[model samples]
Target chain A: MMDKEKIKFTDEELVARFQQGDERAYIELVKRYKDRLLNFVYRYLNSFEQSEDVVQDTLMKLYTSAHMYREIAKFSTWIFTIAANLAKSELRRLKRRRVVSIHTMGYDDSEYEIPSEDFDPEKETTSNYGEKQIQEAIDTLPDQFKTVIILREVQQLSYEEISQILGISIGTVKSRINRGRLRLQKLLKDLKVR
Target chain B: MDCYSFDKVISDYIESNLSAKQKQEANEHLAQCPACSEKLADMSQLLGALRTLPRPVTRPDFESRLMARIERQKQQKESPFIHVFHEYSRVISVAAAVLLFVATSLFVYTSVVLPGSPASVPSASIRSVEPAAALPAAAAGVRPEQAGGVAEKTLPDTNRVQNPDYNSRIMMVNE
Candidate 1:
């Protein structure tokens, strides 16, 4: 999905160029993964505005920490690690604010719009509700389970790649996704209640 | 696969990501049991639906906003915020050290050790420039008066230096 006119650079090329202070490569990188990274964070926190803010912070981190990247891992994997850390930190800050008993700083998950026409795009008419139930069940799962499940099922990353991003063992990633899926099945079990 | 084993295999089966032996076992089980096959169908469909879910379109200002924010941050980092503070403190410290060294050296030179100057320049006045400037003149003028006083007071004392007897070996050499 990369543009052919531009030099066919690997993620590593873009990273190396970025480290050498080439804004073009960084721009290319931002163009490449901005939406994907934003979606991951958005789905994780379930807030578009907050995810946008995180994506900005993530790119800033990439720009600043470019030299800290290693050659062994994929550039996307390295970047997602930073995004995940920021997501973790932001989540912590929001939770602390919530505990003060003030009005919530971030909106609750109900405000999250799944980026799909799978739901009826037309507000005038409603279609099958089964899919909506599945989405809701997924939303109900805890953050850890949800992260693993989304990375595996939605992002379609390999277990090894997910492990590197999350900085957990592959075993843990598998267990978490397994647990997350089972939890979803449980939550959606009575949908067509046998 | 047994029902208990079926749970574990369900994920691998839905992903179509099982080992060969696991795949054979799952196929055997799915051929017999409708329940797991139904679950597998549902799970695979769910996964397929999720994978098909589109990534949200980034807002129009996304790149510019990110660039602006990152530029601000890079400027902050490049501004030498902490580095400037540290260097300023170092400059202040070195200046203080040099001042202290000069002050201490001046104190040792003007006080404590010079024998005749302790009389000519009062300790407190030596701290000021006037007494310091007067010291050489005072010593030069006093030398003559002392010479006359010595001639009148003790002619014999002149023999001590003029006498060949004291330091006679060196005095004879001078003579």
Candidate 2:
């Protein structure tokens, strides 16, 4: 019965309750956001395992930093901001490790294999092919464009929400999304021709 | 509208964010320009694909794992003071209240109640006798023990200086 009542509360209200040390409210917030965060982080990182870790870290941050949330912004915006920052940090860390590994690889190291960035679209068929191509196209975009694209298109967040999450003006968000879509369009066309 | 101008506003047109005049210009450009029309169509398709991308779900144990981590965090966050306080908060609070009550009672007894008590009467009387003790014994021709009474009796004349007699009395004392 109490669970149903909790369900009726809005995300902001749930966060408010969590701020006041209500454990159930925190659980409800987690339940509400876990899948959404996973989707966002997965699109950003492109690895299920890593994305899961990022989402977990994001939630852990939420748990520890609930007091930092202000009612000035929507709870979703704040949580997504946290998830996006973590995902970006993880991406940078991965890139650093990749660079280090490449530099450290010895010519005689038989176990070392350089990872391939190529995706074989021939292996994907029909609906899967389109999705794969779109994902690859998205991956080709710069981080600024990719973030706005995913937030606007995949997560269907508002311009204002994306702006708040990315800490940019709404005009910048709009421009980035427009340019990102244009870039994706060009990339998908190129991929199709190939 | 030229292809360059249309390109700049195409996204806004697709989102219906353009002003009426600008949107109309875009519509006219799209109608005439096959390349721009195709571009718009492709963008629309891309948006659709993006919106329909498969959402991944976390593992079934995700919540349980997260909860366990939260529990661990909660435990870790408890400093020694917080831990001890949490364990014995009621007793500590009660003891604190009792201590505060005793301290307050002591303060009131000393500051407000004690001053009016019979135990303070002797000190009050001693304070009152201080002025009498300050009177000169030689001036009153009395010993220190009898000075209080004699000083009270001679109080009026002490203020009136009978110069010669006072000088003679002082000489007698010296003698």
Q: What clash count goes with each model?
A: 1, 0
lDDT of 1 by residue, B115-166 (tens): 4345434333223223333344456776423423222122233433344443
- For candidate 1, write residues A104-182 as lDDT tens digits: 4345434444443332422221223244565566667898898888778767888999999988999899888887887
Q: Supply fnat for every model shown.
A: 0.36, 0.50
Highest lDDT among the candidates is held by which one?
2
Second chain alone, TM-score for each candidate: 0.40, 0.44
Q: What's the TM-score of candidate 1 when only chain A is evaluated? A: 0.78
lDDT for A61 (candidate 2): 96
Q: What is candidate 1's DockQ?
A: 0.16
| Model 1 regions lying over 4 Å from their true place | A1-7, A98-135, A190-194, B78-175
* Candidates' C-alpha lDDT: 0.70, 0.79
Candidate 2: misplaced stretches above 4 Å? A101-129, B79-175
What C-alpha RMSD separates each model from the true structure? 12.9, 16.9
Q: After superposition, how far is residue A99 of candidate 2 from its true place, in Å?
A: 2.8
Most accurate candidate by DockQ? 2
